[model samples]
Target: MTFASWQFAVFAAIVFGVYYLPPVRPFQVQLLVAASLFFYGYGQPELLPLLGIAVGGTYLFLVLALRDRRWLPVGIIFNLALLAFFKYKFLFFDPQAPALVDIAAIDFLLKLPLPIGISFFVFHNISLLVDLTRDKKAPLPSPTDVFLYIIFFPQLVAGPITRAGLFLPQIEPKRFSDVQLVEAAKWILIGFFFKLYVANNLNEMTSHMDFPFYETLQTQDRWLLVILYGYQIYADFFGYSAIAIGLGLLFGYRLPINFDLPYISASFSEFWTRWHISLSTWLRTYLYIPLGGNRCGKFRTYLNLIIVMGLGGLWHGVGPSYLIWGVMHGLLLAVERPFLKKFEGIKSAGFRALRIAAVFFCVTMLWIFFKLPNFDHALAYLAGMFRPSTNPNPTKLYYDLALLYSLPVILQHLHLNSFFERRLAAWEPYVYGALAALAYLEAGPATAFIYFQF
Candidate 1:
């Protein structure tokens, strides 16, 4: 279930309630595993067996890899294959066909719906195998612990993509007294506020940016919507990550922090470091470093950057737009690399501000590819942004509403929240309470999180 849903609210509450009971303390790991299974299956029970095979198979491989290093690559490939099959199988075969190969098992596997978190959990599996097997001295972890690590309800879906080395060790009996109630409440509240009041509301305006509808938007409106979409996507994904982290804290497991004011970043490389920190970290550690990161020559480093970024883009989905989005980002990084040192030497505030604006403008413009996944549509929209609209009728966007909804994201990137926290220390709790009220009151029409498709 989605984090914004009332169903999830009830589910989280019930799970939280039963989690800390005196009798349940010893079985905390098992409890969380069961709860996670239920949470995942709550929406798609049919996929539970796939989930089982993934985790169980990963665990089996982990054990074998610990004994024989050769098996590690095999295990990693196995997980990658699962990701490839579920994520890209549609490119090769049509699931809607009544019958294809005449093999019931293969057909059943092909026709099954894409599992919601396959991308995330497969990474978890790879990380688990790679991290644990790197040190052959490490003992084999129990199957249940591995299961919990792979499918913990909070991050089982869209993730901060926690690493095996970071998360596996934290699996232990959690104490109620140790729960960070106030901290957790703040995260959950801010998450809900951003998702509801900001992202969902902005979605109403940005929805006009889609296909035939965007063709009806005026040129200026198209530009306005692209910037608004940048804000909306950040709020949506950041909101989900925040909720995941807060829930992790409530259960005494700490997920990685995902975003750190990415829009304000002055460089594309810095932006990657700040935005989706976990995923970037995973790519660096697992993919980049192994491919001889910057340790290789300058030319190799540039090639590595393109390769990683291209694969990272493909990881999101199968499409030319996604590839272009990623490759363009890689190009930005490559182009900026030689000048970054000189740019960093500058001390003027105006220079810094200009750099930030330039980076943000480039990033925002690229998001059009994400909004319009069809390559031609993305080009058409980009082309429209540069020319006057010829359409007889244009969609009227409410600029006031767009500004109101996007203000939070703007203020947040500026770090204004820190100012209020320090100056209004005594009023913090009450301020949160008001925001909670405002979020509920202003919440817009529900939309599935943008990252859910990945």
Candidate 2:
């Protein structure tokens, strides 16, 4: 069920009603688990077994993690293998072709449907196993709680990717605090507003624009589109996280937050720290740390960073674009490390602002690759971004609203980036009000989240 649709609103209301009834605590937990299964299986009922297998397989992996430290490596390998089969079926099948025609044949023959948000789910499950490895003495939970946490519908698609250790333990009985409920309601509403009004509307700006026209537009306009895209995605996705975290709270679960005003960061490292905190934390703890992290030599540290970030990039999609994206960040991180010390004492305000602008521009450009379907398409889009203007049919309302819409991010960047960097907490009221209004607004047709297909 899409969080943007009335289906989800009604779903949330029913869940909330049951959750508030004092006698429904334990049953509500089980009901949520069942609802989650229905959510995942509702569309693709044929593949319900895949979820069951994942749950059973993960449970088994955790069991092994407790047996021997070596099993941690083995279990992870198994999880990766499973992920590869479903997520990388196209990649795996590529070599089976004798001709380009054979590629079509293979895709047809495989009949594999990529599980919705399989990437997010795999990472979350992997994190659970890593947490087990970290605390050798951590007691195993009832499989039900772990199941509930992992399969919860809200974060199942695009995620905050809450660590099982963070959420699973919090499922105990407690009265719903009024403040928490109100806060939860606010987040849910904010998520709806972002996904619907801001992100959804901004998406409409470019949806109808022909590629030929977009390619010929002035640099300023193309750049505006790109910036708008970045904002739309952040609002849509981070908003989803807010709703998910809020819903988790409604049930007495405190999920870790996903975003922290990422645009405010002056550096890529800082940006990752703020954006998708849960995924970054997962990569840092499970992938980076396990790969020896910075504990090894400087060169190895750089290599490890690249490897993790590259995998992190690939984790978003099973494509060459994603691979290059990961490698690009890896290279950027390596270059930034050497330059970090020198830039530390550069106290010139103008210079700092310029540096931030350059980085933001660069980052926004890179997002073009992520947005595009393929590498060649991205190249064409880049050409459009820089090319001579043909018809400069600027989207005035889009431009106006986009700039106005991103004011919060702008303020946060100023405060957090200083002279521009604003503390993330200051937007609390806006977040609440936006979400509440979203909940009250009539939900139009359901539109799937971009990441859900991953």
Candidate 3:
């Protein structure tokens, strides 16, 4: 169930109540495993078996690999193949080719609903296996811990993808202190505000501007829509991560932070470092470093960066737009390397602001590709955003609402960058309370997070 939905609220409440009870506390790991399985299977029960197979198979291969290190590739291939069958099968085999009945069989496979979080969990399993092989001194986890690590509900679906080493230790029993509980509550409150108030409202406000209709809007209005969408996605994804981290803390675990004021990043390299921190870290460790990250020559390093990012983009979805988006970022990053070295000594406030603005503009512009599935439609929207047209003017109400929803995030980034750090910290409770009230009053209809589709 979606975090914004009443169903998830009810589910979480019941789970937390049962979990904290004195008698039930000892079985916390088992209870959480059951709860997490239920959470994952709530909407699509049919996929539970597939998920079980992935988990069980990975665990089995890992066990075997411990015995005969040669089984490592077997384990990686098996997990990756499972992911490929569900996620990228369509990318390789077209369903509608006007062929014989054989093609119809492939079409049926294409029609099967994709299991949610396949991308995330597969990567988690791969990381676990790879880490085990790399660090032979590390002991193997029990089967139960392996299952829990792969299927923990908090970050299971859209992850700050956890590493086995990082999360396994937290499976032991623990009690939450009042201070910890308060901190967790604060994070949950802030997450709800971001998702319910800002992201949801902005999504509703811009929902009508799709494809052909989006291209028909005035240049200025389209630009506004693009900019608003950029924030909408940021709020939606960041909101999910915050909630996940908060929930982990409530249960005495600390999930990794995902976003760190990415919009204010002064370069594409810095942007990647700040945004999706966990996934970027995973890519660097599992993919980039293995491919000879920057340890190779300059040309190979550039190629590695592009390949890693391109694969990273494809990991989000099997679409041309995603590939283009990755390529764009990779090229920007490659171009920025020399410039970054040259500007390393220049740290003036004005120069930093200019650099931040330039990076933000480039990043936001590329988001058009990320938002639109059809390449031609993305191009048309960009065309409309740049060229002159006599479309109807957007209402002042629209402008005000968009600005209102977006301003808090901008201010949040400023605070994160230490613009008003002391003042914000002093007024923290009042600011949080105000945001909480606004969220309650202005919350739009419940919707799934944007990252859920990935």
The candidate scoring highest on lDDT is: 1
Worst 10 residues of 2 by lDDT: 412-421
Per-residue lDDT for 141-160 in model 1, tens only? Answer: 89999999999999999998
Give each model's whole-structure lDDT: 0.93, 0.73, 0.84
Expressed as tens digits, the lDDT of each residue in 135-204 for candidate 3 is 7887889888888899989999999898878887677886644328877887788899999999999997
Question: Using lDDT as the measure, what is the rank order of every candidate, best first?
Answer: 1, 3, 2
**Candidate 1 residue pairs in clash (backbone atoms < 3 Å):** none
TM-score for model 2?
Answer: 0.87
TM-score for all models, in order of appearance: 0.99, 0.87, 0.94
Tell me the lDDT of model 3 at 187. 78
**In each prediction, how many residue pairs overlap at the backbone (N, C-alpha, C within less than 3 A)?**
0, 12, 0
Candidate 3's displacement at residue 204, Å, is 2.2
Residue 210 lDDT, candidate 1, scale 0-100? 84
Candidate 3 matches the true fold with a TM-score of: 0.94
